[model samples]
Target: MGAPSTELQELIELLNSENPRIIQPACEYFSGLSGTVDGLNFIIAQEDIFKQLMKFCSFENSDIALLALKTITNCAQNENGTYFYMACDKQHFCTKSLFKSFENGDERIIKSSILLIENITRIEAGARHVHAFIEDSKLLESLLKIFVSNKPQYQDLSLIFGNICQVPGVRKLFLKNEGEIFNKMLPFLSHQNASCRLGAANCVKNCCFETDYHQWMLKDDSILAAILLPLAGAEELTDEENDSLPIDVQYLPSDKERESVSDIIVALVQALHKLCSTQMGRDALRKYNVYVILRELDKATIERDGNENMTFEIHNVIQILIGDDAAECDDLNKLEVPPEIEKKLTEMENA
Candidate 1:
């Protein structure tokens, strides 16, 4: 990085100016700059400007503060930008300002703050920082309070929860206390907004990675049913099959529809696949006749959008459900894979 350009220096001066007119437009200019890779790189190189923007997050003027946050949010969208926010002594500063923004009472500020934190938590190191931040600040309780309220305005908090739960320590919070917090998040899988649904679905999928909790999640929370409900259509099933299915997914209304977003569908399918890792999970899935739901979903998906990856995952779960367990290894989760096959799996995931 080189010295800041004269033009960049002038803009920084305007941003530092106490006048609302100067600072507002300067913040807007930085907003546009921070949105692109080249422009963000420029802003990142200018430590003074970057620090100024972080300070503006708490500006007395709501407009300036919101714009500064929006700019920071844009910068945090990429890995490099997220690292910049988490680097040096600014991590605590950045996270504290974000949590404070939650109480700003301005809808735009709150949403932007959530989005900024969401982007930060996407990176592994950033997630760790946020996990620690939440733990130390005791902010998880407050966040859960907002989440369980089911307030439409704060629906985007689901995204933050989803991303943060990717951390094992943070995930344990939801898993503990008999999964009290985890159960509250399950209803959002069927939220009216696709983003909320996607977030909650991803959260569920992340929690599914813990094999020990499989039986409890399936029985106590009805988690399998919550995830599967979004994948079921109005396709008719026989009375026997319907009765065998989990109640949440049985006897669909004629007007009932499946989740339209491909990503949510994929996440739900992956969660089901994770649940199949253990014997107990497999038994529960088999008991519920989950295959019946996936069979219809597979057909409907192929007919509508023909998402090959989605159908592939659906088929993968279907195979496990219908496989002869007696002839197969008892511990599916512990099965070893050959190097070539593992490499192929990695390539497929990357593709």
Candidate 2:
């Protein structure tokens, strides 16, 4: 990057001005710049501008603070821009400002802060930082309070929870306290917002990797029902099969629809598969007649979108659900993979 242009220097000075008139337009100018690739590149190259933007997030004027946060949010949309925020000293100040925004009594500021954190936590380094921040600030409890209270329009916080839980250390936090925190997140699987549904599904799927939680999770009938309900359609089931399913998914109206998003469907299916890793989980699923739901899902998915991958996943879950009990492993996660199969998986991943 070359030296900051004379015009760019003047803009930076104006951004530091005490007058709201000068500050607002300067923040808006960079906010607009941050929206385009060339502008983002220019902004990212200039440390002074980047620092000023971070500083503006804490500005006394809500409008200027919003513009600054918007600018940072736009910049953090990609990997390079996200890494720039991670590398800067102002990143801590930016993060503190984000949490402080929650108390500023401005819905727009709070949402912008949440959006910025969501963007940042998409990367591993940022996830680690935010995870620590949540732990230290006891932010997770506060977030759950908001969520359980049915607070309107804070669905994006679920995305932040999902992103951070990808880290092993952070995931354990949810699993703590007998998974009370994790359980609170279950209802959102059927939330009206597609983003909320997707985020909740992702969190469930990621946490399911802890096979130890299978028994605890299966104890809550709602968890399995939540995972399966999205896969259930308007198709009528046999009376016996309908009675056997978890209550939430047992009866379907003629116009009942499956989840529209492919990723959410896939996550729910994968979570089901993980739940089946234990014999207890397998028994619970079998008792619920889950295979009947998957059977319909397989056909529906194939007909609706020809999503072969999702179909394959459905088949995998069905295999375990209906497999002979005598031949079942006590814990599927403990089963060793054959060398050839392991090599094939590695090759596929690398390819």
Give residue 190's error in model 2 in angstroms: 1.7
Candidate 1: segments with Cα more than 4 A from true spot: 1-4, 88-91, 136-138, 303-306, 325-331
Indicate which candidate wins on TM-score: 1
Per-residue lDDT of candidate 2, residues 1-351 (tens digit)? 243578877998898789999999999888998888888887888778888889889788899999999999998887788888877743477787787777777788888988998899888788887776667537778877775666555778888888888787766778888887888788888888877888788888889888877887888677888788888999988899999999999879999988889888988999999888888888899988889999988887876655766776787789888777546468888878899998985665344
Supply the TM-score for candidate 1: 0.92
Worst 10 residues of 1 by lDDT: 85-94
**lDDT (0-100) at residue 34 of candidate 1?**
77
lDDT score, candidate 1, position 160: 81
> TM-scores, in order shown?
0.92, 0.86
Tens digit per residue, CA lDDT, model 1, 1-351: 244478777887897798998899989888887777788887776778878898888788888988888888888887877888877335588688878877777877877788888888877688888887788425787887876676665788888888887888877888888887788888888989877888898888888888887867877437778888999999989999999988877788999988999989998999999998888888988989889989999988876555878877898899999987754665677888889998997776655
Global lDDT of each model? 0.82, 0.83
